[model samples]
Target chain A: MRRFLKLVAIEWKLTNREFITIFFTLIFPILMLLLFGTMYGNEASEFMGGYGSVDVSTPGYINMIIAVTGIMSLPLTLAQYRERKILKRFMATPTKPIEILLSQFIVNILLTILGLVLLIVVGKIVFDLHFFGNFFEAIFTFFIILLSIFSIGLLIAGVSKNAKMATAIAYIVYFPMLFLSGATMPLQMMPQSIVNISKALPMTYGVTLFKGIWLGDHLIDYPLEIIILFSITLVFGGLAVKFFKWE
Target chain B: MNVIEVKNLIKKYKNFTAVDHISLEVEEGCIFGMLGPNGAGKTTTIECIIGLKNRDGGEVNVLGIDPNVDYKKLYNLIGVQLQETSYQDKIKVYEICELFTSMYENPVDYHILLDRFGLHDKAKSYLSQLSGGQRQKIAIILALISNPKLVFLDELTTGLDPKSRREMWDYIKELKNEGRTVFMTTHYMEEAAYLCDKICIINDGKIIALDTVDGVIDLADIDQVISFETEEDIVQLIEKEIKGINKIEKENKKLKIYSKREDLLTDLVIFLKEKSIKYRKIDINRPGLEDAFIKLTEKTRKVE
Candidate 1:
């Protein structure tokens, strides 16, 4: 346990020194939330009309965007660490690789929560938005969405060789999650073929669960969505552990 | 007893053999030097000994523990300083020493180690801000922080200036005085000759020569070198005049006459005076380690 804590402390120190971590992990996300949140404002609902047949002001669109952004955080951070050889150095230490991975996961979770808090603060102060519909359910769904997204990111970072390639591949996975998961547009209004494909994506269930919670829909009806999120987390997390390359 | 032992160890990267089936032993409390050229499998052998790489064949025992099976225990007892000093550029020297020291059960005093390396004043400075020699000093200090019974140093003074190189050598000797065994690899022949109690000279992943410094030098065969400056064709003259002159070569405007005869120098000086040859200078000296290394390796290559 002491070894694990020491490794975590080292990781923290390295993260603090990395300019990219300070920029993308902290500053970039906050700037993005503030900039995008205000630009869309009340028109966030109107922006949702472009994707599908669902009504724009159904409260589902806001929840979808938040979930998708939360998912994006995981890959961006993990890939950066892998590309910089931070994971490789950590592995060279006496600490177990699993401990290092756990520390990174915890740090990423905290960073995502901080970003979420900032987004909410800006949303409430400037855009007059509220996320207070069944706060416990909302928080539960948010945690699930964060875990699912983080798992995918871990998988990508572990498998990829370089940062640029990881970033490219992550975006290839990211754009579809945003566009087809009903984050940027409503999936219900889209063509049947597109909806079917998007439903298979991990982020799709997270967006659906978030919308269901926000709109006070029946949680029992979204069992498949919950199951899909949990399943994706397990599969991706397992693959990450098995195939992760430190160097 | 041997602190570390390897028998016919081999490591292959695909088709190319990095560490051939070579065997050697490191006695406790002795400074063992693995002397070789750049690609002579020194680092590969060191890595294999430290359990950082798996061997394809043969056996290795470090401190009575097989590295492959008992890596955790081996790591606890052994300290390794790789050729390269890699760390977070923003980390201070003190932090690096402290962090690495925490991994061991009994660590040396961090400040004292830093002071020994002359890095006490630069403790708070970031790694990027320090000079290459200073950074290397810090790396060495980090390696010693654990106070391991056996320490591995790979090319410990490769890129340092002359003064820094000598300083590092003194520090290594100090470690030896503290009764710690050091297994180091170096390309510098003088370093091995001066510091190593026993040296294993490796080439092309094979042990060409293994012995004490004086033992190797004694085996070189060639004894006296009679060097004299001359512009004329002295080779033909020496072949005709000097009876016991076995070999002759001209290097840098001086003719070198090699022989085992002790009185060859006196005879040559008399001959030069009697002949009235206006030579610039004359020198007579015995063979050194460099001569031995060249002669042994050169003969080995010819047989191959």
Candidate 2:
């Protein structure tokens, strides 16, 4: 436990020095919230599929923030560690390889929570955005979504040959989720075909669930989204653990 | 006591064997070297002994524990310095040191280790900010920080400049003086000659020769190199007259005679005097590890 905590602490210290990850995970989401908040004001504007801009889009952008944390931050760091044989170095010690993976999970989870808080605080202060419904449920739903997305990221991290390949994989998964999965734009505004495609995306389920909870939809109301999120988490998370490469 | 014992260790990758039934023992507190060319399975053997890779066949005992059975138990007793291990680029030296220190149940004072390796001043410097030699020093310090009874150093001085290499050699000797069992692998014959108490020459995934430093050199058969620059061309004359000339080569106006005979030096001088050959510089050079490695590997290659 001590070794695991120490690894988590070291991982945080190391990650804090990365400017790009900081920009995308923490700064970028807040910037998106501010941009949309300015353009669509506090009133329930029809610009966001009849929902107010700050009301629904801010939560969606917050989903994008967690997506960056999962898809980009997790895989890139793991791949870099593997590429540089940092994982192999730990294999020589008593510290098992799983400990490193767990530590990375802990560190990224903390960062995502911190980013979520900052996004909420910033939106409330500057844009008059309010969480109309259960805040605690939103946090719970965010964790489930994080688990699903991070498992997919871990799969990429496990299979990539190097850091460059991991980055390419991350971007390939990220851009689609960001633009089409209701993370950046509203799914209701899209054509039926794009909505159908969005329906197939895990991020779509994540955004819809978070948006529901932010606007006061109870957790028991969305059975399908909950099933999909938990299912993806179990499947990809298992594969990630089974196929994880230390070298 | 043997700190490490490997018997007929076989590591196969699909169809090819990386380590082919190789066996050796490293005695306690001795600097043992595994000397081989690339792809000779030196690294594979070390990895297996350290429990990083699994072996297909045979036994590996480190600190009286089978590494494959309980490598975690051996972790505190054995330390390994891999050829190209690295930390996160943004991590500071001291931070990495502390991280590794926390991994061990009982760690040596990293401050003293860092100062000894001349990295105390660079403790706050990030990994990317340090020079290659400094990074290598930190790697060594990290390996030793756990105070392991046995240490494995692979290609320890491969890319360093002469000064840094010499400094590393001195530090390795210091480790020996501190009573640590050191097992190292290197392609540099000079490094093996200077540091290794016993050398195992591996060729084509097998042990071709194992002996003390001088023993291996002596076993190479060509024991002495007699070279002289003659005003008169006597290459052909000496080749015809010298009874036990093992090999001979001529460059420009100088000639070298390599012989395994015990009295080749005396016999050569007598021949020179009798032939009235005016030799300017006559010197006898003892054969070293390089000559032995080439000869041993060549012999093994022929058998294969």
Candidate 3:
């Protein structure tokens, strides 16, 4: 346990030393939130109309967009670590693979929370938007969404041989989730075929669970969403752990 | 007792044997050297012994523990310095030392190690900023921090200049004084001659010679060469009349006589005087480790 901690500490220190990585990982997501939030303010109405029949003013759609954006940022952070060989060096030590993966999980979770806070803060201070329901429920749902998305990111990083390939794979996996999860376009407006396909995506379940709390509507019960999200987390997380290549 | 024992160790990569049926033993508290040229399977053997590579056949025991089954226990007892010591560019020397030391239960003091390597002032410097020799010193320090019972050093002084090479030799001697067993592989014959109590010369993934330094040198039956600049064709006379002379060659006004008897030198002097053939200069050269290495490897090649 002590050895694992030492490895984690060393990895953390090395990660911090890369000034550019810190800027992109921790600060760049906040920058993106501010830039995108400002550009789409009130204009989210026009963009919603092109998707066909959904109302732009729905609070659920707005909240899903904010939450899915935060989840997509997880992959960029992990790909940076893989590019630098920090994972390979740690594996050569006495540190177990599980501990190394856990440390990355903890770091990604903290960053996701930071990104969430930035989006919320920007949403309230700039756009005068407010979340609809119990604060604790919203926070707990957000946690599950972030965890599930990050596990997918972990799987991508573990399987990729290099950063360039990882970036390409992350984008290929992320764009469909963002576009189809009722984040940018309401699921009610999308064709039934697309909805049926998106239902298999973990992000779709996340967006549904998140939207439930955002609009205070019991569209899907919280317990069922939690169970589905947890299952997705376990399966992807196990595959990531099983196939992870330290080098 | 032997600290390391291997029997018929074999490693094959898709029908190509990298390490073939090699066997050797390293006694406790001795500087054992694995002398070989490049692509001689030295690194493969070391990796297999350390459990970094799997062996197709044979048994390996380090400190009475099987590395394949008990690597965790073996890891705690042995330290290794590979040819390349990789690290993050921004990590400072002291941080690396501390981090590697923390992996073991009982570790030597980091500061003291830095001082001993004359790297105390560079403790705060990053790895990218250090010289090659300094980086190598840091690697050695990291290897010894655990104060392991057995240490493996691969090409430990390959690129160092002469002065730094001598310093590293002294450091290895210090480790010997502290009762540590070191298994090292090197291409430098002089380094082996200076430090190794026992050496196994490996060629083509097999042990060609294994013995004390002097014993290996003595195994070659060829005698030394005595060369001199002479005005006469003394090579012809020496080849015909010298009783113990094995071979004689002459080129560019110089004569070389190879003899098995030591008294051949005295006889040659008397023979030259009788012929009134005064030589400009003469020198007698004895066979050294390099000569034995060439002879053994050449003989092995011929037998194959």
Candidate achieving the largest DockQ? 2
TM-score of each: 0.82, 0.96, 0.79
Q: lDDT of each prediction vs. the true structure?
A: 0.73, 0.89, 0.74
- Candidate structures ordered by DockQ, highest first: 2, 1, 3
- lDDT per residue (tens digit) for residues A1-247 in model 2: 8887888999998888889989987898888888878877878765555566888887788789888889999999999999999999899999998898888888888988888888889988997887877968987998999999999999999999999999999999999999999999988789999998998789999999989998889899999999999999999999998998888
Cα deviation of A98, candidate 3, in Å: 4.8
Winning model by TM-score? 2
Local distance difference test, candidate 3: 0.74
Q: What is the Cα-based TM-score of model 3?
A: 0.79
Error of 2 at B64 (Å): 1.0
Candidate 2 local Cα displacement, residue B162, angstroms = 1.2
Which wins on TM-score, candidate 1 or candidate 3? Answer: 1
Model 1, position B40: C-alpha lDDT score: 76
In order of listing, the candidates' clash counts read: 3, 0, 0
lDDT string, candidate 3, A1-247, tens digits: 7776676686667656766545544565445545555656544254444321122222333334333333333344455545664443343345454576676566555544554565556556666655556778777777777667777777887788777777788778767876787665568779999999889777777777776676565534677778888998899888987987665
lDDT of 2 by residue, B149-265 (tens): 898998878888888888888989988999999999988899889999999999889888899998898888765888889767777788898798878888887888987787899
Instruction: Name the regions of candidate 3 deviating beyond 4 angstroms.
Output: A42-94, A101-105, A111-129, A133-247, B220-223, B259-266, B294-304
Minimal lDDT window, size 10, model 3 chain A: A50-59
Error of 3 at B294 (Å): 4.3
Which of the numbered candidates is closest to the native, going by highest lDDT? 2
Question: DockQ (Cα-based) per candidate?
Answer: 0.30, 0.86, 0.30
